[model samples]
Target chain A: MGVVFETVVISFGILYRYNLFKREKERLAFELEINKTQTTLQLIATQEAERKRIAEDLHDALGGNLASIKMNIQNMAPGNTQLSTVVGLLDKASEDVRSISHNLMPPEFSETNLKDLLANYYNQLNNRGSVRFNFHTSGIDRRFNKIDELMIYRIVSELTNNILKHSHATEATIQLIYYEEYLEIMAEDNGVGIAPQISDGIGLKNIQSRVNYLGGKINIHSNSFGTTIIAMVNYKK
Target chain B: MGEKIQLVIADDHKLFIEGLQSILDNHPEVEIADIAENGKELLEIVRKKKPDVVLLDINMPVINGLEALKYLKREFGQIKVIMLSTYNEEHVVEKAKAQGANGYLLKNVNKADLIQTINLVHLGQSCFPYRLPAKQGLPGISDGFLEQSNITKREGEILQLIKTGLTNQQMSEQLHLSIYTVETHRKNIMQKLKLRNPAELMKFIISNNL
Candidate 1:
């Protein structure tokens, strides 16, 4: 009877220790998985930052010099007739180059207000200036964290570019408003709105991905009035 | 076509200044007298150069574009200033636009629009990249454009009358739209355009060439 009792006690102790070890192992595994995911995300973010910096450098430095050289070359033709023809050709070429440079990096993001940035961006793409751009904001002075600021900037800018390229919007409005705990950014356009299904354009996906990474809520609405995008991120101290 | 538009650039980034200089060096319509890297430089340039237009950046090393705007306006009454910024917050933008910028151009603006804006602004049109409601001296713009785009011709006329700096009731008396209707339209226009800050719309009207 004593031996049987001892055996039962021993078995229960062994089982309990085994279960404890298994639980700890599982917890560590989960932590490892989380750490790996975080590292991967950080790596991708760093790559994107480097890419943007390089693109900006090229646009500002290389693009400007090239435009100048091309213009000067067009002027160097000997005769008036030749100069006119060359200049005209050069003008087309320069415009094309400018467009390329514009796509490489959005220069307008540096502007102080969203109004001019969208207005300037849309106007450049729409030759006839048919798309009217409007922006309005009301609230206390709010400055977001650096990462949040950059993300918002990219989202608004990328959305505007998408509208210009795809939506055929004749007008766009961007609004920034602060609610209780979040900063909201709204971008809307008066153009052919998106259908129910979102496309696979890298731009849209990129935006969605970025918002997701930031743990922000993005709501997209499309109708006859046009497509409107609302993105909100919680303020982090 | 017009005299090279007198220009002042304010930014905190040295690289951006370099980039701008590279572009300005080749632009036919621009005459960049000097470039400042901060708000202080902007103020100093305003005193010395008194440029026809100042391209002010909102996020600066010191003081900021909004504050600089007040100073520039007080010191240089006739000079036109344009707010250049990265963030498109309407509140801050509206504030800058109202401060008497001749035009507001985005940084994403390409080489051509940059030149065109300066030329148009120099010619006395409030030059903006995209369309803005055309108002005369920002008078009724707050009520007319912001209130509603469904404005009847009479409402427009009345709004224009208001923009010449008229009182709401006075505008109501002028336009057949009941004083209530005029106020409603004004509110509607603002809502549709999402222009919550009338000062910003007013600023947009005053700064850019119409």
Candidate 2:
């Protein structure tokens, strides 16, 4: 009886320790994986930066040359029909290149107040069609560090575009509230709500990605009323 | 009749700075009031310029974008900020949003979108890619759904990590546990909370203001 009891106790101890050890190993691997993912993400960001740099170079360098060539061609050979046609084609191609380059690099953003820029677009939207828009500002105290404001402005604008295109709504509201500790951005619209059974969502996914990148939380409500996105961003300087 | 949208952009990249300047230079109304190379320079400029909007970057050289943003937001609560970055990391975006960025956008965003956001920000609007929140909640949160019966210390650790944006592998490495153990802990957490997936977890955090 005593030997049996001792054996039982020893086995339990062995099992507990084994489980603990296994858990430890798993944790180490998990950490490694997280590190790997972070590194991968960093690499991706670097790649994106490089791509933008190339686009910028192409725009300033190649774009300039192309524009100048078109100018020279136009100046020299309006009389030469063949040359004119060729130059016209080249000019069209150059315009396309410039557009593509601008798309890749995002030129106008860097120089403006991100919020104002977005608001201008919203104004345009409000002016153009029938979408009744209301934009409110609350947390107007804390201006972001370099390059931060543009990101915020762009994201808000994109959401508005999405709403205009997909929501098919007549009215939308955007609110920016600045809290003592963090910031909150709320956008809502009244239209036909999203279908209940959404399985393969791509736009929502993109929105999710952008929200995730901000390290913010987004709430999407698509009921009979419409779609609402309320995002909360924690302030971590 | 349009409000003068006061603005500032802070970044270290000279080429991008120049490009932005050249483009906005054409906009007769939209003026580039002030531009800085890094976070510190940006802070000083903002202090002086007092623009209504400030565009900040994430990864700067001296103090980094996040830190600078934190400082600025704390000091100037009225100025709106939008975080700009080339990468699209969810957690980073979340962090920026949390830290009070009025908006978030990718560097590869459209020029029209960029202009539109400035207007949006000026108009006092906020935007981001939207996602659902997590469902299952804190240990003692609301509906008594979580087991709350006999959760181990390890289980609690795993929950905290999950809330902090750490993946399963990250939890394992941080806690010195095996992948299997972390997975098991996750299972146990879900089972206890009666939660389904990560979305649920996120929801719970938001509902509880975690």
The DockQ scores of all candidates, in the order shown, are 0.06, 0.02
Give the per-residue lDDT digits (tens) of candidate 1, residues B90-117.
4445566677777776554555676777
Error of 1 at B67 (Å): 21
lDDT of 1 at A142: 41
lDDT for model 2: 0.65
Model 1 per-residue lDDT at A138: 43
RMSD of model 1, in Å? 13.4
Where's the lowest-lDDT run of ten residues in candidate 1 chain A?
A66-75
Predicted candidate 2: interface RMSD? 16.5
- Which candidate tops TM-score? 1
> Model 1, A1-237: lDDT tens per residue?
999999999999999999999999999999998997788678766965775676556554554444445434433543568666655665565455455645544443443444454445554444445565555444543456544555676787788777867788876766665555766666767667775465666888888987876778787766555676777777776
